[model samples]
Target: MRITTRRRLTRAGMYVLFFAVLAVVILVTDWGRLAQQFFQLDIARDQFPEIITIALKNTILFTLISFVGGLVLGIVFALMKLSSVAPYRWFATAYIELFRGLPALLTIFAMAYMVPIALGFRVPGGQVGAGLIGLILVASAYMAEVIRSGIQAVPKGQAEAARSLGMSPTRTMGWIVLPQGFRIIIPPLTNEFVLLLKDTSLLFIAGSTVLTKELTTFARDGLTNTGNGTTLVMAAMLYLLITIPLTRLVAVLERRLARGR
Candidate 1:
């Protein structure tokens, strides 16, 4: 057989395998039971204004505050990592690697509990605040690398032109380089926000009041109260509603970048 014929046969086999598995799943699933358990609109309705007002609001608030905090921290560290000063570079490198290597859960736990116990320091705003700080630490670690790469991606000539125009190094970075670097980084930074939004679910580790609860904690409590899976499904749907559009935007930005290039 020719190479194209062999490839065609392979593709046909894959389609057959895919549909066979899909058919098996469809046949095995009990649609009525699934809906009864997970699609209880009556129980879902009980979730009410609180889910939207309190849980989702807190989730969004946490994500925005952490993202903004992380962005600022990321910038400082990124600059430090690029500094001519050896100590600054070393400290930045250590911070990024250490946080990136640790689980966000552990960091949140430590911030919420251990810091207060060991250091005798109260993390401002209590457990929820500590969780946000932990998130900021982890996020900044990742964003620092993104920012450094973005800054480096700025054409050296742009900085050179600014310098030649008698701009100080700081002024060149501030006025000329950072604006372009941030533009180049917008897609990745948007992706980071999506990740942070999901990570807010991890704040469950830090505990919360009803008012402070985010989606995951709220949904877990609802699951207990309703004794049905509806609230969990609702939480999943809400997460999708928030994430899907952001994910689509990332793809669009990537495509636009490709086209521009």
Candidate 2:
């Protein structure tokens, strides 16, 4: 009846219940069927070299392009959002709100199909280009807010110090505030990179040539050809291989930043 004894008994019961459920599930499951569907080594082998060289390569490439494009545009939008000029603030706000409110898939579809048709403009690299552009636009909207918060988080004293030392407002912001703000925001930015990496899977909606296909498309194609889930499993593993390290890096950066603070 003591509090500590009751707590230990409850914990032991929870553990027992968890194992009981797990044992029943394992007993009822068909290991042979599961292996045939998702763990067929021969089917998995067929996807080899190309899965890594082509599918995964394209995923990483698309992510890098989108992240770099987004970061540059995000910085510009963040600056505009903070600008003294009313029009700049208004435009930036409208853009951020619009993209943030829209589903990324819808935005990608529009970029790939609607915008080009309406404007009679061709996006270079065709569908792939438009998909990347859409990703950049969505990413910039989210990142603009991140960058804006980071910039605002910088101490006002740093800007005042720079101004007192004869730096112009622009110079102070560019040299002092922005750099310090970036340092403050590195952990979140790294986390954004991980999210963007996963987001590259959405590019399959825009369609791709075999050469440009990322992991999801590649796995789906493999599934169609092999009629096994192994390809999907392989693709999932590749995604984990890339994202797990980046996520761990984000945690490390956060801890380091906290220590610095």
Candidate 3:
């Protein structure tokens, strides 16, 4: 009882210290100015719709395209990495490491300027098209790692069992390993989608026409028009609105996967 009492006192002291620090910070900072800039009501209403239409839409579009592209390419990369052939594994590993190490913005810039110049070809939607391709490349690297791990997580016995049942190597992998691996990958893949949604903001660096401008760009334009920061806040809120649901979905998937395991 005495030890318990002492522990309670220590906990209470930590809380008091935290509150004291918070009070000092509040007193030292310009709370009124921060509130006025970030929480201006009329400005939020004026800019929020535009933020939603441009930023939210583009973010969703980028994530969907990148997720689809990554899913397809990641599966192939994972298979290559798992292959018995030396060159396939080497090529897959090199591809994954190269894109994973590079910044998404640099990749987008290359796709926008360097690729087009080198190839002497126009990307269909100009900067937007280039940005999406860049996102797909970067996303594929990380997704490849996720998929490789998932495929590896499957029991070796499952492959042997399939082969014993007269399944060819390709058939065994297609029928047994991939389905189980995909189930294990679902939660992490959803998390990757959430990350991709946030990363779409980097597209602004590649530049876009007004119609193609995403959330950050749209908010910046709104800020310039209204001379207020409310647009930025609105953009943040809309991103949260979309991402929060996906995050919750990820949690549910994790629980389901855990239970299945």
Q: Model 3: per-residue lDDT, tens digit, 1-261?
A: 699999999999999999999999989999789989878988877765656676678778877998898889988898899899999999999999999999989999999889999999989878788888999999999999999998899999999999999999999889899899889988899899989888888888778886787887888888888888888888888888888999999999999888887
TM-score of every candidate relative to the true structure: 0.97, 0.98, 0.92
Mind sharing the TM-score for model 1? 0.97
Question: In model 1, which regions exceed 4 Å deviation?
Answer: none
What's every prediction's RMSD, in angstroms?
1.0, 1.0, 1.9
Model 3's TM-score against the true structure:
0.92
lDDT (Cα atoms) of all candidates against the true structure: 0.95, 0.95, 0.88
Question: Which residue pairs of candidate 1 clash?
Answer: none
lDDT of 3: 0.88
Clashing pairs in 3: 55-215
